[model samples]
Target: MKRNPMDFMPAYFTVAFVWFTTHFGGGFASGRQLVEFFVQYGWYALFTPVIAIAINALVFYYAWDFSVAHQKFQYRSWTDAFYKPYERVFSNLYDVVFNLVLVVATAVAFATGGATLADVLGTPYLLNTLVIAIIMFILTIYGANIVRAAASWIAVIVITGLLFIYGSNLVVTLPNLMTVLNEAPAPRGFWYALWQSIKYAGLQAALLGGYVAVTDVLKNKQDVKRAAICGFILNAGIMVLASAVVLSYYPTIISEAVPVVFIIRNGFGGVALELLVSLLIFLGVISTGVNLIYGGSKRIVSVWAKPEEGEKSIKNKRIIASGIYVFITWSIALMGLIPLVAIGYSYVAYLALPIVVIPVLYKGITKRGGEKGKSNELDAMTAADGPKA
Candidate 1:
């Protein structure tokens, strides 16, 4: 039965936070993404983020609803159904995109951890990366459920810290922000700025696999609508807010390897807040990397290894998979946070825009959003009627 968006608010927000937390990791925590993707555009930063985010809302709504309607919860199956006729090509392409997302995401998380700590401790960046990798390797070995629960709580804490840090700093930096808006030239121009914004959305599109994977939580089309609306508001809203905060500092803090740490250390807050933000970012790094690493490990084990039907076999492959992926990401992180976000991430966005974002947006607009419009849809217990799919 169709219900109001207001109904099932808890479940809707639960789904919404998944997208928000997924987006709000190392790239976001450091604020480099905002600077590289938006703030660099000068005044254009004001609206471009919203544009990219609007696309994310639409794409996620269609992808998730289509997944629920068709009962293609796993990404591979969904790709087969959604990309039919062209599935032979697009399906394999999307596998490349999703796996690349995991690599970039895990690497960024590691780099964020390394850079954040190295900024404070005067430690070696690669060593810091290894330390973070080792910690995650040990934790993920325990199981997924523990880290999943920890990630939820860390999301709440990170949100609170963001508000406390940025909210206060914005008021103090209002004059600086206004001056930059009036004086700084938007060197990239309007069209180029818009392309960057689109690419930013494309980089985020890589997460559709993770986002759509959870749509089984939506009982009906109403829940899907609510989740999409809430997802856009929270995810886009936070990015815009971060843009505003980072914009206030403008060209000076923009070049910093870690903008959040720069802001806190310079004057935004005292030593205590700096350490606090660092701790939160570290927690986010650990949780995000652990979860993503496990996903990669699981995929490797399930697909190629196809371990014998036993926990022992599966666990052993998982350990090996985790180690290999971590080593790959650790090498990537050595490039430093700025190069990884600006250079490495931009390449992924360019790749994802064509295969992942554009196709998903096309399907979302052209296809029937859900099975609700079908006359021969299934009854309860099937996906159409939505009894837990």
Candidate 2:
């Protein structure tokens, strides 16, 4: 029996959710990235996400090419194909950049958690972040897969909570948003907005590792295409709405460490919704931080620990590596969430542009978007053939 096209809709959505969840981590979930990249730029922020969408989707479409076509799912092997003959240098280079990405992303996660905790608990910012850091260290040193397994569902739940909160806020404050747009300053910030969007797109491109790492579920170019298109819609649409929510309050929203949290506490939603979302943000960032830290620790174990040495030695390296990252991220998180989003992510963008974005764009354009010109296994497989007992 031929499978209905809709029969595989869920699978395609799962892939799209992978991209969304990776992108929607601590920084995004906190609503800080929206403020930094779009809301701060004034009314033009309304349209900046479109520019960002183009840049991001362009990178995503081509970045997935080498991985999907060649069945390179692991980050290292995937990079081997993306950079091709020069994988020797560029792959090693990307490895460094990705580790740094892990660091910044985790640090941002801690910072986000701290901010959310402080808002809910009225604790000291430093103390909250430190506590969050310690918890992530303990959690990450133990395991990773369970959290990775939950990320997709986390995306769904957190996104639902955000949509309701932001959407309701939009409804309540629609007039405010409209007033801001109409009275939006005459300067019409253009170049600055686009530059921020570019920076944001480049910074996000750093996570191409996380995104492509899961493309194993995608069958072929068509699967990749639908997933990418779905990604663009989900990422951009939600971002635009979030930015509008922030813009409704304008410069006041600027002061918030976690704008969405601020909105909730300011009486946008009922107490129950606030608590649930708060818990979600707290768990969400911790999970995100732990997953990334554990990934980095495994990398260290692979490099410094020879499996033949003993299981204890390997486990020790893993623990030690987690501690090192925990300390570094603790220090970075001290700079607070805004600095992490504005400064830390900006640096990541600078690193990502040449290493991830430019190379892929070059490869994509020169190779005609990496068309295989023949049927591949991924494209030929039926839905039922993907998994075997």
The candidate that wins on TM-score is 1
lDDT (tens digit, per residue) of candidate 2 on 68-177: 77765546656765675678999898888888888888888878877777777788878977877888777665543333344556667877877887888888878888
How many Å off is the CA of 24 in candidate 1?
Answer: 1.6
Q: Estimate each model's TM-score.
A: 0.85, 0.82
RMSD (CA, Å), each prediction: 5.2, 5.5
Cand. 1 Cα-lDDT: 0.74
True lDDT of residue 103, candidate 2 = 80
TM-score for predicted model 1 compared with the true structure: 0.85
Flag regions of model 2 displaced more than 4 Å: 1-9, 123-148, 186-188, 294-298, 301-327, 368-389
For candidate 2, list the clashing residue pairs, or say none.
Answer: none
- In candidate 1, what are the lDDT values of residues 1-389, reduced to their tens digit? 22212343355665676677777878888888888999978878888999998888888888888777776645665677778778899988888887888788878999998888888778887788888899888866654333344445666777788888888888877787899888965987999999999998998887777665445556767888998998888777777777887888878877787888877776578888888888878877876677666655655654544324456566677788888988898777767678778887788898889888788888787873433322111111111111221
